[model samples]
Target chain A: MICLSLFLSFLQIGLFSFGGGYAAMPLIQEQVVTLHGWLSMETFADLVTISEMTPGPIAVNAATFVGTQTAGFAGAVAATLGCVLPSCLFVTLLAFIYTRCRSLPILQQTLASLRPAVVSMIAKAGLTILISAFFLDGTASLIRENISVRMIVWFAAALFLLRKKKWNPILVMALCGICEAAFCAV
Target chain B: MEIFQKKQRLPVLLRLFTSTLYLSAFTFGGGYVIVTLLKNTFVDKYHWISEEEMLDLTAIAQSAPGAVAVNGAAAVGCRIAGIPGVLASVLGAVIPPMAILSLVSLCYTVFCSNPWISAALNGMKAGVGAVITSVVWDMSSRIVRSKDPANTLILILSFCLCWFGGVNVICIILAAAAFGVLRSLHAKKGGSAA
Candidate 1:
């Protein structure tokens, strides 16, 4: 039963989430917190923290954590496989079709329509994560309390450095994390 | 003898292995950062696909399954190479973290209450929050710039529903899908009537 739940939750995450791992957060939050009752909101938040800190996609982190919590190591494998299986299967199939229809106008039109929908899904996922992060308990305390101001400023600075100044991402993330630790201590 | 020519595919495997290492080592800010790196390597550096194709592939990858970064990498690999590419990319993405986590999990049990590690993680949490916020802003600007009122409205509603109302995201996704489909149909019907 635990295995089944892990499979289904990840499968749902795989099918519905658009725009990537961050976009899957709300769906993951819902499944882990509200539906399955496997983890608490606080734990989910903690998982998000770990997921962001660790190297890999958020979905994979969630799968590993949730699977481990529910059914040990095997559960972790089950969840990870469940999450990634869709991508593996879809890409392979799409590859086959793409080769055959690389020049078809009708296929192109269908893909065109699908683009806006994909954009919308990605947008929605972003909104969900923003809300989850900054506006907990139906309040924007993260901003109002000024707890996140410095962090935001540093994040913007990092973004500028990465985009405009062409800095490396690893350096930026490390610097930001260091700055954050310093500020919090002060 | 000519018909049985054995093509050397070792370079492809090496590329896949290296990419996997890069992903596991450098992906700290989650999926979007990985995607950006992928764009740098696959699209800009390698010229595997055009920028437009990359965006389309990203969309499809996000909507498919697994981690978006891994999925995107696999899609690009399959597109550029073949089944071998898929294996190489996925293995590249999954292996490092899996090994690291196994070690961490072992140590974590021993250090569950270590003050230094705990404090470090607490500080890291704040950084994670900041990273997530940056991801949201980056994605929103890239994907939600239409002047369409309906799109704008849906964005606002979805934010409010999830953030304030605490509505289930699965329901919100379904609602958004239905709303988009119905709106598109209505626009088509109105166009025909005119």
Candidate 2:
């Protein structure tokens, strides 16, 4: 039953995640954290961390990690399969039509419209996770005392490197970890 | 000719599988990264696909509802070897992440407990937030650049609905798509009348 739920939840995520991986983050958060209670907000943030560190789309990685966490290897397989099913099914059909007609204006318009919405979803997910990282508590409190200055500093540095220096995200992630570990050791 | 094509099919499928596997395994930061890798390998290296077709495939991949990386691969796969090709390519794309995440999940408890690891994750979590903010910034700016009032309106309204209003994202997306379709229809009618 757990495996079935994992599969179905991911199937919904896969079906609706139109923009790309990052755009799908909120939907994943909604399913795993809010709807299912499969993972807490903090663990969901950790899942994003691991997904970023790893070498795949966030949706697939999330499915595998959450599935494994909840129901072991079989669950991972089920969830991963669910996640990819939409891609396999729809892409093939679209590919066929695309090769025949060479254009899809309606599809194009829908995608154009979707771009802003996707950005909105991504922004919300980022803010939600950002709050969890900074506050370390639930989203209820908006107190200044809840903020973590170290995290804020690291976030600024990371954003600077990412935007100005064009540093690879994996490299930035690794640097963040090493620097944090070193700071803690001292 | 049919016999020759049949003989060539298995090797092409095998190559597709292995190439996508390597691409998916090595490309970090996902999405566009893997798509670029796919272009390099398929268009430039193997010469299995042409550049123009790849762009169209990318469009279809992007517009369709799924991970761009997987959709792109499946489109390329369909072009190359049809249904069997899709199967091979998707399996290739799926395996690396599944295997890697499964391994990481097994060690997650260990990851949580270790002080160094926990500290690292804390830092990485901040990094993750920064990265997401960057993505949001980049995408929003692109929409704003279009200067289309409707698109801009959609962007602002959707952001407000999702973030402040606590509306479900799925509804926002559907509404946006509907708005887009209606706007296009109106424009087309105006064009025809004019």
Candidate 3:
């Protein structure tokens, strides 16, 4: 039953998570924190950090982490499979059909119509992250108290540097972690 | 002898294994990051496809099922080396992460409750949030480049609906699709009548 639950939970995340892994964060948070009680808010936040630091998609990392926590190796396998199998199956089938349908007008039209919507989904995901970071869950108090000002500044600085220099994300994330630690200690 | 000869027809499985390893090992910053990396390798390095093809592949990968990074790799691989290439690249992308995460999960089970580790991760969360915000900003600018007032409106409305209204994303996607199709049909009719 636990394995089954792991599969279903990840399957839902994999199937519905449209924009990307970051976009899937709230959904995974809801599943692991609210519904399943598998992880605490702090731990979920940590998982997000660790996942980001690691090499794969956050969703895959979260699934693997939560699944292992809930059950074990078997649970990890179930969740990972649940997360990836849907895409694999879909792409494989699409590949088969694409060869035959590449020239079809309706398919082209449908895809063209979907483009803007996909862009919207991506943008909405960004807004969700912004809201969660700055405003959600009474973190407004921290911002009001001026404790979060440095953090915000760091964020903005990092954004500017990243855009201007095209620095490696891993390097940027590491530097942010170091700055965050320094701020907290001070 | 005949069976052995048939078995040697194509090294599909071998190619799949190689491609999967390559993607899984090299992909960083998750899927979006991988998309950029893929463009570098496939377009700039390999000349597997043109810039336009890369953009088109990204669109398809986003709309299709599974991880965008993997989907993009698989499609590109298929384009380059046929069905065998698809198998190779998808497998390459999936396996390493699975192995690494599996190991991390094991270690996490042991150290998840450690206070120092917890504190470090807490600090790291703030950083992760910042990183995600930066990525979103970059991607949003790219997506909203059309300068079309109507597209801008849809983009804003969609963001508001998803972020503030908490509507189901599938519904939002469907609404956008409906709007697009209807608008196109109206335009076509107007063009023909004119």
Candidate 4:
């Protein structure tokens, strides 16, 4: 039953997750944290964190992690298949039609409108995660109690290095990890 | 001749599978970044696809649902080898992430509660948040490039709807699609594609 539900839920996510992984974040969050109670909110945030640190698409990683937690390896397979099967089924057909009608005015305009809306969806999902990470604890209160000033400083520095300094992403994440470990040891 | 063609095709499929596996396993940040990596492998390295075809594939892949990286891989695979190509490509994409996440799920929860490990995880969480922030800004800036008042309005409206308005995203997107369909009378209207 658990596996079946996981598969169905992820299938829904895969189908509706337009605008790529980032756009899918909100829907994934709502389903995993709010609707199913499979993972706690903090745990869900942690899932997002680990998902980012690892490779593959966010949606796929999320499904696998949550599935593994809930029902084990078989659950993981079911959930992953759920996430992927929709894409495999649709893209082949959609791409063929889209390629055939590349210049259809309706497609172009729909895409144009979608582009901005996609941006907004990303912003909202990103902001939700950002706020939860930066400002929430077990219970999010506008400003999370556990968020230390040091953590904020480290976050900002890492962002600077990755963005303006153009440092390697792995190195930046490692630096944060090491700094956090060192401070915790004290 | 068909048998000979089958013999010729094996290596092509094998190469597509291995390269996608390598990228899926190694690349991080998000699927969008793989666009460049795919270019390097398929175009620069193997010469399987032309730069223009990659561009077209990427556009179509991006417009479709699912992860861009996965869609991009599937699209390229289809272009290069058809259905078998897609299977090879997608299987490559999922295997690495599945393996890694499974490991994390099995062991990390036990370690996560340790004070030091907890701290590192928290810091990592913060780092992830920062990366997401950068992505949002980057995407938003590009969208605003078209300078369409309607685009800006929709951008704000969608954000407000999703973030504060409590509107379901599917409805917001559908509404935008309908608006576009209705207002598409003037392609000359300056709404540049993001």
In terms of lDDT, which candidate is strongest? 2
Off by over 4 Å in 4: A1-79, A138-147, B1-85, B104-109, B186-194
| Cα lDDT for residue B120, candidate 3 | 41
Question: Candidate 4, clashing residue pairs?
Answer: A135-A144
Alpha carbon lDDT of residue A172, candidate 4?
67
Stretches of candidate 2 above 4 Å error?
A1-83, A94-106, A138-140, B1-93, B101-108
Question: What lDDT tens digits, residue by residue, belong to model 2 across residues A4-37?
Answer: 9999999999999987777899999999999999
Model 1: runs farther than 4 Å from truth? A1-53, A57-59, A62-83, A116-143, A182-186, B1-9, B28-30, B109-194
Give the range of the ten consecutive residues with the poorest summed lDDT in model 4 chain B: B1-10
For model 1 chain A, give the 10-residue run with minimal summed lDDT.
A127-136
Two-chain DockQ for model 4: 0.41
In order, candidate lDDTs are 0.62, 0.78, 0.63, 0.74
Cα lDDT of candidate 4 equals 0.74
Per residue, candidate 1 scores C-alpha lDDT tens digits across A24-134 of 899999888899998889878767766654678777778878888788888887777777777788876766566567466444534434444444444444444344333
Let me know the DockQ for model 3: 0.30
Arrange candidates, best lDDT first: 2, 4, 3, 1
Runs in model 3 deviating more than 4 A are: A1-79, A95-113, A134-143, A182-186, B1-89, B113-147
TM-score of 1: 0.63
Give the RMSD in angstroms, all C-alphas superposed, for model 2: 7.3
Give the Å error, residue B16, model 4: 7.7
